[model samples]
Target: MFTSAIPSLRWLQGFEAVARLGNVTRAAEALFISQSAVSHQIAQLEAHLGQPLFRRVGRGMELTMAGEFLLDTVGKALDHIRSGLGRLDTYLDAQLLTIVCPADIAQGWLQARLHSLQAQLPNLCPVVSVDETARYVDQVDVDVVISRSPLQQAGLTERVLFDDALVAVCTPALAAALAQSPQPGGFICLEGDAMSATVGPHLRQHFAGWSRRGMFDDARLLLDAALRGLGVAVLSRAVASEALAQGRLQCWPGFAPLPNGSLWLAQAQEPRSALIEQVVAHLLSETP
Candidate 1:
């Protein structure tokens, strides 16, 4: 299955390396080949494409417009190939299920439910990846992803996990003290831009002279600070639900909870197996 229109992968690799490193010697060193071999491959690639992919710029090579276009396309192709190769583990191990989600969601909500999830699927070997910046499942090889917002990518199905709310919570002892005194105190805040904007005005209007004690990008960290009696932490209600239920933390009185974004569970439309479907169902059933 050789396509005459397409250049050899070796030639493309050499071309990409030279374009990136800007020197044939460096590209050869990276590829574990001689400098002449790299140069020869690049020349073959240029001749096959009927264009000069690079031009000599002093000691280094600079890509031509055509080379730039090819580099972009080739880079994406290589990345996709690499991701597919990395996912061979899932194919070899049928019981493995890789789930990716935000760190806060992982620590706050999902951690408590692992035992129950395993009980539902005894053969399941769950691999949870926590990345606060992850917004899409395609960025990695994952069986399912929990996201703050619904993903609109093609070939993906999304299910609503739960609606979230931002609430101010503190230790029960702190709440009792605040109830008696009714004075402004140090506040722990989430560092999200939108959340900070909403919380800043509310704190100023309701609790005048409120000073920030700590700011955390992660809700789990913010909750930890609040539990230590550091300050009143404004975080996702779901993140603090377990602690609140256990009486380790309490919702501060007089402040209404603010509506927040919903969490959505998303997976490929064509799941790898029936077990994945069962796992998804179990998660949905467990959601309140």
Candidate 2:
């Protein structure tokens, strides 16, 4: 077994800044230390490595072969450290718990319940990001992901919110008008960059014969289109609940609820902070 010598972080940092700037003075300025301090740090680092890191070339300094090797290794090490620290910063700011999910959920479900959540946890800072792509679980920076897809990532925990029960809906007037003839021109469908797999095929299978006037990715836009009597739209019951209850949109009869994977609240199993646990509990409680 081989053991590598460990160098001081301060020495490594000084060497990296100097190597990058190619000037001791500039590196010292950047590091906010005296030029002598920077030179001393580099000397200490080179002494540990048993090699000369720089050679005098007129008024300037050039990297030796050993210096080049060290530069490459140390540069990467610094970058990795910086990246890791950035990610750590995200975790440290426990005041905010970021919830990443589909736009439909943001607009239809979470947005409405946001105030209630804030009221329940006054100190809780929740940041909601709308992923039109609906791949929030795959985003590394996301703290909590509400996914319609199954949580397959290793070391991640999931809690099922509710099974997807979707319904075809349009304005009451449109439903009444289209009852006689549910043509292609009276149907709306999801097209590009659709967030969920459940919507398109389910619509096609059930309303296969219904004519489609347009296709879109935005659930809110689709809902708006339905409200304007553009065509019937297939939407998750939770997303369409408010519209249905208020009579803004009415469910078209003869279509039973379409089945899909249950909505899942997913988070990393390890590094489970109390704040994250609190937010997860709140979401579970709010699930209908």
Candidate 3:
């Protein structure tokens, strides 16, 4: 079962780690080994495969053409192996679904509706992960992910959860002040993030003449700023519902809701489990 002519799995593991992270030190840290060890493993792997797998570029490393080919094949193998191993343990456990979501959406929407999930899936012991970068959803091997942007990975089942809407709102006093002046940069603005990409165009379209008195990346914080009368803010309906109902803030007149597409729920298609199916169904039916 062993041969010197064949490369070792340890070498392959090291190669995969290095290729994914593009840093030998990070790969070593991920593998819980010394950087020197990772470098040695990569060297041995290259020697065995008879090809240069990586090349130094500026301050970092880039995969070679050979490296890309190996990664494309090796990466799928690794994912399959990991998924298989994960399925061997508690795969059918109703309480074992792991859900990944964006931070703002989690704080604004999912947190409020968690009780509904509990009521419908009493056996679900949900583990929630908040990843704004969204780089490691597949690597973490989550059971489900609620995403504003689709991950678009292969072998994933996509389901529409709900559509999102953004509206401009602020305290009554702030609204009155804006009505008086309506100068450029007079509103709170969100820039440089996924939420900004989704809502920024709508904001400029509605308040083309207004100026930004404040800028925020977090929608919840933006809502708070709006509540304190800092400036008018664009907020998702889910995040602004309570404040609007309580009369804490009023909507800016003449701005209608802008559709932000459906929030998608995705999971691997194969190795399907009843637990995942049931929970997804519950989320679809009970999210009102």
Candidate 4:
């Protein structure tokens, strides 16, 4: 309240533009204001300081020596301001999105689809955050969000990515062991509590009497455990199909590739940022 130094942001803005453009008309257009208004503000500002800031030329204005000195200071300050805004815009645009998903879904679903997403959205760089036991959507701070949710919120939009089919999977060695021995305990099931929440109850109801020895949150982790012949894991066709085809994963007959893992990509409902909108379009076409 007792400060001797106080400056106006609008005056600085007006002064900066008028100095750079050397014309009130150009300054007004750049500032989105009327030429007469800019003139009035400049007049008021100069009057308050009791100094001449601009000299009138033939239908134009030129910076005075005092204005020249102030211009240097103003230019530096404005450049810094513009630089800050540029950085802020990138952060908001998700030039890179930190995608949060269950560890396995990131590996099985998202990672598999990354090449397609990258191909479609050449500018997008999505960073994956592994969180398999996660229950809620973790993209409040990130630009793009891809995950399954219980329901859509008021400010977020949801797109159906794919309908995933679950099937029990095992490594070739484990499949051979099952083919030879075929006993309950011999079936070293990959234990994962995370699947139970996302795809477990359905497995329990449909594919009964498989050994539950291990639990995992992400499909990639579960697949890895199964690949090592640790146990069987209930995973989606999207997650298991390639592995199965490559002979790394084998399906147990009659399990029916139980229906679960309804994939959804959630994003802000309003689509505030242009980059977010592009990501939504790219994700819709991404195959991973």
Instruction: Give the top-scoring candidate (TM-score).
Output: 1
Q: Residue 95 deviation, candidate 1, in Å?
A: 1.8
- Candidate 4 wrong stretches, greater than 4 Å: 1-89, 93-98, 130-141, 181-185, 188-220, 236-247, 269-278, 286-288
> Tens digits of per-residue lDDT for model 1 on 1-93?
223597888998899889888899899999999999999998888888888889999989999998999999987887788798877755447
Top-scoring candidate (lDDT)? 1
The clash count of every prediction, one per candidate, is: 0, 3, 7, 15
Ranking by lDDT: 1, 3, 2, 4
User: TM-scores across all candidates?
Assistant: 0.63, 0.61, 0.54, 0.52
lDDT agreement with native, every candidate = 0.81, 0.75, 0.76, 0.69
- lDDT of residue 246 for candidate 4: 69
Tens-place lDDT digits, model 4, residues 32-98: 9999988888887787677888999998888899899889998999999999988666656656665
Write the candidate numbers in order of decreasing TM-score.
Answer: 1, 2, 3, 4
What are the root-mean-square deviations of the candidates from the true structure over C-alphas? 9.8, 6.5, 13.1, 8.7
TM-score of decoy 1: 0.63
Residue 42, candidate 3: C-alpha displacement in angstroms? 34
Of 1 and 2, the candidate ranking higher by TM-score: 1
Q: Tell me the lDDT of candidate 3.
A: 0.76
- Predicted candidate 2: what Cα RMSD to the true structure? 6.5
